[model samples]
Target: MSSFLTNSLKLLSGAIVAVALVTSAPALAAGGHGRKPVDPGFSFEGPFGTFDQGALQRGYKVYREVCSACHSMKLVSFRNLGQKGGPFYDPKYKNPNDNPVVKQIASEFETAEIDPDSGDEVMRKSTPSDRFPSPFKNDEAAKASNGGAIPPDLSVINKARNGHAPYIYSILIGYEPKPVGLEIPDTQHYNAYVAGSLATQWKGDPHHVPAGGVLAMPPPLTDGRVTFDDGTPSTLKQQAKDVTTFLEWAGDPHMVARKQTGFAVILFLILLGGVVYLAYRQTWKGHH
Candidate 1:
């Protein structure tokens, strides 16, 4: 019995170590122990808060010009952008597929499909219903292009990490020069917002550890890299906020609808409870 107990403990220890190694990489990449992200205090905050269409449009532009190069949003489609509550939503176009803007955006992308007449696979202009295309052909190609790091899909990236938008926002603008004493690899960038322990990489004072983490992805955004059509200044902060907003919308296209429904349900439940109470009192008014 004692021998079995010892073996069980050993197995548990081994499992714990394995799990740590497996999850450590993702944790490090994401902003785990890094500096807290700044709250942008977006317009879409409270239960009744609605998405800002202008910001969404600008963010989409930023994504199209910059992020779309490395990350892919496989879950979202052009039609989603014209949905009732989406960035380019137009009430005139009830069906997002019928939206002219959506059709134009979709046509810009080329996807592989089998031609009905020839039955041969060919690249064709994408339709509103098609999902966003990935930059790399496959995982191996993606890794080869990105220095062996497979960029995470951005479809649900906003929901993947805590403090979603703020976390993403901080990381984008968090690039900074390394401290005078500390040394980092040329390939890696020092972003204070990323989550990683740098004991192995830190050569600074033992008592004063570094404040940020390092990541393979360099500063993805630069001021004036993208020009907003709405005339919003292309500052780093604006770009970060706009892109974060777009990501939030991408991650939860039904967020506004979901919140509105929840509020209505709560109000309906309250009214129902009141009615039940009044009915019970009226039914027993002559008695107790």
Candidate 2:
């Protein structure tokens, strides 16, 4: 009897631990590589948190002025910016397509249209329905322009990376001076956030191999690179954070709504459990 009780207690403890780990999986999975990612304490981090509208808008500006030079967000349409929960969403515009701000933003870009009468392709101002155009015509062209490195699309980059927004934030501001005894090609720059494998590149002690990886791209952000209309200081960290926020929203636009639904479901489940427990107790009360 004593041994059985001990075993049962151990099993229960193990089950509890397993449940805890499972519940914390999302946070754990969002962690970074060798170097830890800095948490910017974003508004949309916790279960009940929502996207920060100002950050989203500023981030969009950063992408437009800086990142757009190389990277593309092809998955996002111009009208997405004016949709509910988006950066430029206005209550006045129920239809994102008809949103004047979105329309104006789209029209700034020239899109190719075929003239019906002349049967000739002509460059016309883009509409809200248009997707963000790629800077390069093709992958080969992008590679050629970028020294054989094709910039990854920003549309879903936050989702694609393991550390999510934090990892991207870390990378954007992660450039560091190269460590001694670590050799990399001239084309590659060192970023401390990466988990660099130095199996062939390390000339130092095997046990003390440096943490970080080589990047094909140099540091893309600088202080005051973008001036914010809201008067937010355009520091390197701020730009990184804002752009990361925008990328996060682009990657998972429905995150806040999904979290709300999950919270509702959890509340319902808890209430259901309570009701079921009460029913069970009532059914067995007299007999017990």
- In terms of lDDT, the best-performing candidate is 1
Q: In model 2, which regions exceed 4 Å deviation? A: 1-33, 117-120, 286-288
TM-scores, in order shown? 0.85, 0.85
Q: Compose the digit string of candidate 1's lDDT tens values, residues 83-165.
A: 98898999999999999999999999999999899999999899999999999989999999988999999999989987688
The per-residue C-alpha lDDT of model 2 at residue 131 equals 91
Cα RMSD of all models vs. native, in order, equals 9.4, 4.6
TM-score of 1: 0.85
In candidate 1, stretches whose alpha carbon ends up further than 4 angstroms from where it belongs are: 1-32, 116-120, 279-288
For residue 5, model 1's alpha carbon misses the true position, in angstroms, by 38
